[model samples]
Target chain A: MTLAAASHGFLSPTGVEIAFVLVGIATLGAALQTVTSRQLVHAALWLVVALGGVAVEYLLLTAEFIAWVQVLIYVGSVVVLLLFGLMLTKAPIGPSPDADSGNRWAALTVAGASAAALVWVVVDAFRATWIDLDGTVQGSAEVSGRSLFRFWVLPFEALSVLLLAALVGAIVLSRRGGDAKGAAETSAPAAGEERH
Target chain B: MHLAYPAVLAVLLFCTGLYGVLARRNAILVLMSVELMLNAVNLNLVAFDVWLRDALHGGQALTLFTIAVAAAEIGIGLAIVLLVYRNRGSSDIDRLRDLAERPAGPAGAAGSREAQPDTGAEATA
Candidate 1:
């Protein structure tokens, strides 16, 4: 289908519009939950919702490769690992006492200002240029993958090393009580002590 | 030529996620908020990619890399959050004040008793 037909054609236009609205609503809902949820796991789940919404948006734009990557990398791996970390660390399962703090107002003010600035910059930059949205991008994995491994190869390799180091660091940090003595010292007394 | 829909959605998602990052104290929640913001950016990228499909096709390629990098980031970010929780006895951002650059765990001279022990907190507190 031509770009104009996909956008202005009767069935496609309505279909696209409905998809856009639904995706937008879902994204907004998830974003709200990601911030306001008291439990860490709940927030992570919301992140999944938000990320999934993005994937759906990509699908709407006919970028199937990018959409699947969104699912595989973000929703599947990232959020799951995040939940694993929360469980392993034993973050408070119940409602956290101090979900919001005294500095909330300050943080909000700064975030608001930054967002405003970003929005202003983007709007000003694109004020005159009109974007044609009923277009298709040849985002097949072959094209994107080749480019990433070619001209972007150095940065990609650097990122790999960085990730490897981070993985090793995580293993070492989390496995601190590796020896029996440290393990015993770490947990033996905690079984008996109770604090209010 | 109407890009208003995607733009509005992107702005809304970003603003809401920003609010969450600012309002939430749990490290995991904060990380989730970051994910929200990233998704908003992804939407913008794909939208622009569709708009400029006949051009360089840079946005879609960048989005692919972004997804990969985001996954790796979450992996390490979650590990750090877990490590902080283990050392601080709590994951609340308020309680993690000692993480201002130097590692503030038992490796320092904070002493085990005074140092935060997440297991201890979980067992007793």
Candidate 2:
């Protein structure tokens, strides 16, 4: 029975669409849990799930290159960095009582309104539009590479520079305390000599 | 797949992130919320790219740029959050209220003066 639906042609909605909806629901559920989870570590882990779902969504959209990049950057690196931050900062591994503020109701209200507005506008705009997935594969690395290096070369280079700067900035900010401590230690003797 | 499917999904994800940002007290969680929002934007970009059927695949290319920028932003943001946690012994954003102006008391004025020379020495070092 399910195989019949899976074999449906391009004209009819098929298993791919079913999988997309399922992944979308899972991703949305994970995202909500990520935000609402009281445990900091758990929240980070849930974020991993949510990001992985997004990567799968990209693959379903047929952008294979972007999907891999999303997996590598978001699921692989960013979530690890977040966990490191949480551990380095000595955040409680268990439920954090202070994780939430008193403005939950207000925030939910705003979020709901904005989401409704965005969904309405998008559906109204693209209600009749249908993508022809049977055409040339646009999600391949070859096509993506050409587009990236050709018209978007400038922004791509700028992004690399930005990443480098952020790397340096993070090191500087995190090490500033150590630098300050070392300076204090070395300057203490100099101040004593000046006093004498 | 209908364009509205991914579009609506993105909107829902973006809104959840927004709620996280506004309601979360921990700075690290707030950063995670920001990441969620960025992912939502990437979904929209990719969906539009496929829908438009452009020769250059501009939406996907731009999505790549967005991913790179998001990585950088998260790196710097986490570093700042760690620094604050180290100095203050907590990462609660509500407790980080020192940015506001306050009336200068005699003790506060003298304290600033005493710290100035130390800062100058460190600057030169």
Candidate 3:
């Protein structure tokens, strides 16, 4: 059986419609909270719901590997790390005065335009294409892993290096400005001349 | 009607995420919103993957890469946000305006501006 049937076997179209609506509602609720929740941590929690809904939708569509990976990487690691950073930085964790301000209008304008553009592109491109639900195999982890290390190897390695550079940059930036021994030692000659 | 499901979900997810990215000041919350947007894209990819399972598994492979890149993004993004918060005592994107337009300024306002592209849809949220 295809992953689609595995997800919901023998369901009436109405049943699928009901499930879709329910999931949509849940997804929207979490998304709203992600934006509107005053607490930073609460926003992250809401993101979990939104991400989880996507995973479920993937499963329903027979893309099991993508679904599980979404759970693992996005829900498990990414959000947890975000929360970790939030705590480490000592963010207000509550209502912040700067959270919403005069820029709301500007932000809304930009966001709306981008969304409209994206939706337009997607809809326009696919307007004539019909969804073929023929039970063909797709989304196997083995196949995807091979492609990653094969044809896409260069971009993959580039991403790794980029991440490494970002890690080092973060460490350098986090150090106190005046305390770097390298900078202090280099400036010692100038200090001596000034004293003379 | 069936095709509309994925399209509608994509639009909603994208809009909600856009709102979060714009309205939420906390760096972590902004990251979560980005994840929402990525998830929206993933849905599109998988839908296409299923629809066109012949020749080249394009969508599934792209989703895999997207996941990897997202991981790296979170790692780097969190570290930078932490550093900024430590130095400035806040993660509010608005406050980061201090870095605006400074030549050779710390990975500055462009980052905030890049994260703020959803101004119009954000109001409906």
Candidate 4:
């Protein structure tokens, strides 16, 4: 479907666009801080903000289910997992001077160059494209569930298998690591009992 | 809304993740950045799925899959990192560069050998 570019000028900003731009700005800033923050925990906190902003964006795009999933999976669990990992790894509570690697400037330059090129290409390629969000609710839980089960069931099942493998792999990796041989040996019978 | 909005946002977020993966000293921080990059791609998928109005909603399905995969990736990645830290006594990526080809001869090799037992003993203790 060819949307009329002449009618939808860039100057004519709709309410959705304005909201999107504002939230997009906040999301981008939060993302910047997530990468650049000197304090490790602060970076994870900033990541929450960024991911939440993306969830908000999903809501704005009328993807209600995706938005909620984004929140539940990302904000609710992923960030918490990251925090636990940080603590388990004995991350410093205060700011650490060496949080950044030695190639910071090089990384910045590479990121900047790629961002510039990608932004230019995207803006240029999609200048005429418009998203018609006023029509059917494209991403309601009902719609998402129907499509996910109908057409994507195979992959969904495969994904469950993948997740299970990851689960077992993680357990064994941490359990049988050289550092915890005695613990793993003791836990073996317990694991076997649990399996039954 | 113009598709460019989400597209540009995804691009910037991906690049932010690129920098993080490149510049972070901590293993967990690198994983966080990887999540950022994956989230950015999900945003793009959602936006385009909405724009194209795909009948099967392939983009959204793929997004869900990507998110699940990312979760799995993080779990496995953290497990690996924790194992490394247990063995090496540090989670700093740069310091864990034992695979790097060093020009130094037996001195460096002997030094690494000497340090191994100490780290192993510390880990067991």
lDDT of 1 by residue, A38-141 (tens): 76777778778888888888877777789898898888888888888788767678777677666778777876787787777766665444345444445667
Residues A1-196, candidate 3: write the lDDT tens digits.
2434334422445555567677878887888788877776777788888889888877767677888999998889987888788778776756766656566777778777877887787776655444445455466677667666767778768877877886776667655443563465364434322322
Candidate with the greatest DockQ versus the true structure: 4
- TM-score of each model, paired residue for residue: 0.73, 0.84, 0.73, 0.88
TM-score of chain B of each: 0.75, 0.80, 0.76, 0.83
Give the candidates in order of DockQ, highest first: 4, 2, 1, 3
The pairs that clash in candidate 2 are: none
- Is candidate 1 or 4 superior in lDDT? 4
Candidate 3 interface CA RMSD, Å: 6.4
lDDT digits (tens) for residues B1-125 of candidate 1: 34556776787778777877777777777777777778788888877777666454677767766776777677777767765655556777866544344456656665544545743454343
TM-score of chain A of each: 0.71, 0.83, 0.68, 0.89
Task: Give every collision pair in model 4.
Answer: none
- Stretches off by above 4 angstroms in model 1 are A1-14, A112-136, A149-151, A177-196, B54-56, B99-125
Question: Model 2: per-residue lDDT, tens digit, B1-125?
Answer: 66678999999999999999999999999999999999999999999899788887889998999999999899999988876675556788987765444466568878666666755653333
lDDT of 2 by residue, A6-69 (tens): 4444466657678988999999999999999999999999999999999999988899999999
Instruction: Say which prediction, candidate 2 or candidate 3, comes out ahead on lDDT.
Output: 2
Worst 10 residues of 4 chain A by lDDT: A187-196
